[model samples]
Target: MGKSTASIDWLHRAPPVSGLERIEAYFSGFGYDPHRHDTYAIGHTLLGVQSFHYRGRKTHSLPGTTMVLHPDEVHDGWAGSDEGFKYRMIYVEPALIQQILGGKPLPFIHNGLSNDPWLYRACQVLVQRLDCGLDPLLEQDALFDLAHALNNAAGVNTSRKTFDYQAAERAREFIHGALTRTITLDEMAEHCGRDRWALSRDFRLLFGTSPYRYLTMRRLDLVRTLLGQGHSLVDAALTAGFTDQSHMTRQFRSTYGLPPSRWVRMLGRT
Candidate 1:
């Protein structure tokens, strides 16, 4: 199979927006291996067939359909046919989604694909182009629309259970401030003024991922930025709070579906 190394140049890169990274790429056959991330992989396949295994079944994403891969959901990607596939994706952290949902469970789009017009339109603001950078206010508005469309499309039960959004958000803020330090559940609980176990559950429910994973993701975010700024992998990993480069590499690959070096190369930074 011919890898689209030439197409890498067509990939437009933009700075992240409130933990949201946007990219547009074309894959000439197999794309990414099975991987999971602590953020929702929201995207639209612009061309060809985007196939992936999600929720125990192989799903094909076509044009005009929105793909919402829930946080931490294992999935892989490949073109469904020999012609390859082109897609635009926005990786949004659940904390950003929770900011709009206000402590509700993250919305789930069954089978990882949706043809709902509302969802398609809402996500279009972010996935429309790789070079389209969202302003602060516009980004907030887009996130709100996306969250609403997701809940509406999924028909999520809003009256299921009550959780403290304030508490979870507080812990999330603390994690952001202390990403360089070793954080613990007890410390987060004490800081957020809630029981350790309750706070942990609330964090997972409200944010769609565990507290540890959230912390790790934040650190990984830093690692990406550092590496983009020309820092060596070892230095970036160590500075980002990982034990070592290998440990950071493992986590990075697991979350991003590619090793750090490959990711950099694909960005044409090398």
Candidate 2:
């Protein structure tokens, strides 16, 4: 059957963004070209069915289901229905997930879909359409859990390695505490007492992400909390060391899955 496709108006229709990134919506039959991204694509189908290809398989995903597209995976998006489909997704860098996963291999989505309770609940931990400050260690714990949950869901067997968890954790803390200012691997090395490349590799191994990405997430985390406290988006962006609101917003949606306004509204309701 023939189908019609149109773009989902991100400015008018998308929900408020939380930290980093949140949900991104698009119309069914609206196919994104076969493309690769340098981040993780985490999303759920809302209306009709959404279909895509990954790891050389043709698969279709439905509402109530989660779709995970690993970083750098070649994939294409299209509606699975005649009426088309609508859904929202968050594009998170593998670095973030990696940090959470503790530098394990990126989670594979051969199934390309999941309905596991753990996976569902992980997605929900993030307040929908709202941004807020994290508890002192809540975000750290959440990332750890998300990493473990995704690892288990993907059925990856943990690998044995002579890795130092303490050093990586220390590096993450140093990075997190200084997001409002510039950072460098040299500084991280000095703080963590590891050479730059070795520290970067171990950081990825322990957190499943890089030091730079971890810091960016920290900044995004701050932006959300500041915005919730009645701070102007532009002001929050500047204060967070982001180039501007738009820059922060773009990266924010990619990480948390929605835009800032929608996230703010959701936070307001809570």
> How do the predictions measure up, each by TM-score?
0.92, 0.58
Best by lDDT: 1
Model 1 regions lying over 4 Å from their true place:
1-11
Q: How far does residue 45 in candidate 1 sit from its true spot (Å)?
A: 0.6
Tens digits of per-residue lDDT, candidate 2, 228-266, equal 789989999999989889999887766644567766664
lDDT of 1: 0.84
Per-residue lDDT of 31-142 in model 1, one digit per residue for the tens? Answer: 7778888889999998899999998999999998999999989998888987788899988888777777776788888789998999999999888665555777887788
Q: What are the clashing pairs of model 1? A: none
Model 2 CA deviation exceeding 4 Å by range: 1-43, 51-59, 69-107, 115-149, 156-159, 224-233, 244-270
lDDT for each candidate structure: 0.84, 0.66
Question: Model 1 TM-score?
Answer: 0.92
> RMSD to the native, candidate 2?
6.8
